[model samples]
Target: MSTSKGSSSRTGSQIPAIGGLDLLKAEINSKHTDCLKLIATNTEGNPSVVRSYISELDNSSFILTWESANPSLNGQIVFDFKKPLSTKAEILNHISGLADSAITDLKSDTKNSVRLEASKQRYCRYRLFNVPGSAVTWFMFAFAYYAKTSTNPISPVSAVLSVASREFFAELFKYAFYFRIFEGIVVFFICLYISSAFPKEISESDVIKWAFSSVLTGIFSSGAIIKLARNLVVSKAKSKKIL
Candidate 1:
């Protein structure tokens, strides 16, 4: 659209003023990919059109507007670093909630479906620090080490995999148990394979040394030892629950 301007009477000439407004709201559509929220916005370009999660907007007029017009912005530098104001109650509530989570997270594991939320699900499995799973992992680890012979002996790997996987699936699908078990199994097996399998054949005494050094490895690998110690100390104070 082009506008042609003509001269008017010099003394009584009036110039025309033209203006338009564009308001847009960004929303998430796909539950899988649209992870970012429209916390805020600024005057920007129209190149950020990767995925459209445009949900409902408050303005009824814009709600029915053409979808093609609400283009996304790209390479936009939006800085609202000026800390937003918070009330005293809000501040106190935030602090109290953080404290509650810190204390309860050590003792509990709640089911959370918020994928976009950055969370510490491992804290949910804080209760099952060790014990049955650890024992199974240790046995499976040793077995996998021994079974890596000329023959394909995956007995230990298979057995422990099934147990850990089953427990992991059965327990609200929280794979912390599986993660710990699998990590334990893999660490020892990797150690065993590296020392004995590679670089010719190793001496029996050397094998024993590597196996023993794993004492520290096991303690640090899955925090089983540390959690166990904490459990004992905290349990003595009161009947603590780690589930």
Candidate 2:
């Protein structure tokens, strides 16, 4: 399969108003400490301090984000309403309170305390999981899963080929190639098992005959089928990219 690079252009907006908005909503419902330092880029004025959350008013339909770029602007007051404040002032007050509460909690917790250390560990592990680093790690994980399984241990090469075909072919053609390879492997093992199971009756001649037939009729047939399917895939991918 061919990979293509697409071009991207940057705009005037520093941080998008909705960047990482989904994560913010999730943090509100879950009891977790998520401290994110975002560097804002804008055309004018100081960068805004945005606090995102999914309160009651929006029904979580639209992402609710609060910003504190200018404290001296106006309406620097506290909030009293609790049923998911909708008005700008109410939401800003709620964010301020939330920030103050978070700060208070941080101060109460000792810097080198067990709770703080454990939290740091947990966050670091979670960060590692969330990072988009390498496909090798995921491939290794899949290999491990297959190795430990008792039945249907997936062949990594076959799995890779199957996925590549799937990306190119329709459902019917994809599955046909997948099953053909599967069948070829199964027939080989079955033949070996049968000959071994009947040690005295199954002779060298029978074993040779079975092996020869399996490759000629089974594995060879599968290879030809896959080759044709792969050619078709290449044609389609080329056409799509051209258009």
Task: Give model 1's clash tally.
Answer: 4
For residues 1-243, could you state the per-residue lDDT of candidate 1 as single tens digits? 111111111122222211111111221123312222121110121223343222222211111111123443222222111232122222223223333443344332332212222231111111223467557755544443343221444665567545653223223222343465455556556645743433212323444444444444454543543343344346445643543
The model with the greatest TM-score is 2
- Can you write out model 2's per-residue Cα lDDT over 172-237, one digit (the tens) per residue? 443554554565467556646744542222334444554454344435544544555566568668
Task: Give the residue spans of candidate 2 off by over 4 A.
Answer: 1-196
* lDDT measured at residue 148 in model 2 versus the true structure, 0 to 100: 29
CA lDDT, every model vs. true structure: 0.31, 0.36
* Count of clashing pairs, candidate 2: 1
Index of the highest-lDDT prediction:
2
Model 1: residues with Cα > 4 Å off, grouped in runs: 1-35, 40-73, 76-120, 123-243
Q: Report clash pairs, candidate 2.
A: 14-41
